[model samples]
Target: MTASPLLRSYDDGRLSLPNRIVMAPMTRGRADDVSAVPHPLTREYYAQRAGAGLIVTEGLWADPLGKGGPGIPGLVTDAHVAGWREVTDAVHAAGGRIFAQLWHVGRMTHPVTLPDGELPLAPSPVRIEHQQIFTKDGWLDHVTPRAMTTAEAEATIAAFAAEARNAVRAGFDGVEVHGANGYLVQQFLAENTNRRTDRFGGSLTRRLRFAVEVVEAVVAEVGAERVGLRISPDNPENEIAEEDAQGTYRTLVDTLAPLGLAYLHIIERGAYPALADLRPRWPGTLIANFNGPQPTTREAGEKVLNAGLADLFSYGRLFIANPDLPTRFAADAPLNPIRENLIYGGDAEGYTDYPALTPTPVG
Candidate 1:
């Protein structure tokens, strides 16, 4: 059989991607909870999966207050920086390119995870209902978050900028702003979560201001060519609701189009045809992902590629189960099943212990 297009090299003048298969970010809660630092095995886990064209690491909190749960790795303290540096070095030594995903869970956080039991900060006092936040103690009811003062919001933007620099210092090739998955950025975008009347919210432009500013600040710290943004327009994950999903996201993409970003990674499982609409609108590289009960398969990604909808495609759970994902895709090798119970808060039993069929090429 001929080699699939998914395995072909892509050089777009900016990102010289070796293949279209991107190892999407998946949060594996295995960090040092108290220190918010990654363990040594984290390095081996990443290095073992270096066959992917690019690896967008699991979301890490840029600020101490940005942490959403236990074992969430951080870039805030010096210890955090050193821990991540080792992970980056391992991936690099294996000849792989990696991007740090800067994340802030915002109101998804519980007071139990916060400093001194302070309320989580969000665009407004909105809290997610129906779902509860899982903490170290146990499952806790989502509490109403404190509305972030305008000054605090500005400071948060700077914190992302600072961490972008920190990621570079740790040897990351680029940084992706985690604007998707109903986190802080999406909270500001969604009308139900953002009830602020200040410049950060109220209208379309205002609603997108926080996300746009965060991206711009990070781009300034790094370069536009080294920055990427992820978004899930109509995805109601974490109880987020966007009344005008199309308009809200259209304006956001159009606004950020001219910045010459490295790429725009989007989750395509929204209620609307978000990927179909935004693919043509975005002028830069486009990375597409589909979310569901099962892990993303090569067949699903091929459909997107054949439709001319995306330049790259990403896999989440598949990467976790099969460390040599690109090689397995090439050989049509059977993949290892994911251990649901050992996915989070575990040792090497589920993480670095996953066996690879054979060694994969670095590039």
Candidate 2:
């Protein structure tokens, strides 16, 4: 079978690959709760799906305050680092490359999820529109978060920088900053969420300050070649909506363009225009998330390759059910059905139970 340009090598020197299909970062909530480390089973789980050209590990909390819910793993302590080392080593032993997705949930978290019911942080002290959050004390309505002061905001940037350092030390091939899905960084970028009047708010450039600063910090710590940024222009997951959608993200992409970052992972949203528009502006690799109908079918993936919309394709739910997803995609075989009920906060039920395709029985 002929390979599409989507399977071509990345111009960025940070990641080497035989194809361009990537196993997107997914949250499995299988961490060692007491120690805040990855469960041993988690290592075997990722090792099972080592066939993808690249695998982006689930979001790992950078600090304790960044925790969104119970069971989410972290990279804060020596134990966390040691636990993740096993995971990365397993992937490497299987001849697969992976990147650690550094993340923070911001106000999407509940006070109970925190150490002592401490208020979550946000750019403004506004409560988000009716949204329920999972906490240690069960589900609860999200409360108005405490507005971060300039000092606190700067310190938060430091915390993210430290997390990037921790990720490298934890034996990851590279790092991807979780800037999508209405998290802390997305909250700051969205006008409706960020109501501050300081350098981090008010104007487009100011609103994008947090994301730019985070990327700059990571670039400084580990070089831009190893840093990737994930952004979704029209995501409504955490009630994120920007008054000026296209203008805001265009500026966001253009500003980071000069940095020569590894890749821009764009989660496709209908409100946003064709990703091809952002292509000429960003010289680095472009990875698109297929969210809507038609999905990223082999035909559609090939079309994207021919049209040059993205350099790589990020498979989300498909990665969940098919550990050998790349091979299945190549062979055009039937996929293992995903059990939605077992998507999150479980043991090895849906997390690692998915089976790879086997040869049929002889007649």
Note the Cα lDDT for every prediction shown: 0.92, 0.83
- The estimated TM-scores of all candidates read 0.98, 0.94
Task: Estimate, for each residue in 173-239, the C-alpha lDDT of model 2 and write its tens digit.
Answer: 8889999988899999998889899999998899999999989998898888888998877777778
Off-target runs (Cα >4 Å) in candidate 1 are 358-363
TM-score attained by model 1: 0.98
CA error at residue 89 for candidate 1, angstroms: 0.8
With candidate 2 superimposed using the best TM-score fit, by how many Å does residue 322's alpha carbon deviate from the native?
0.2
lDDT of 1 by residue, 1-363 (tens): 347878889899989978999999989989988899997799999999989999999999988779999888998788888999999999989989999999999999998888888889999999788999989999999999999999999999999999999999888999999999899999999999999999999989999999999999999999999999999989988998899999998999999999999999999877888889998899999999999878888899988988899999999999999999888888888889998888898789899999999656698
Among the numbered candidates, top TM-score falls to: 1
lDDT computed for candidate 1: 0.92
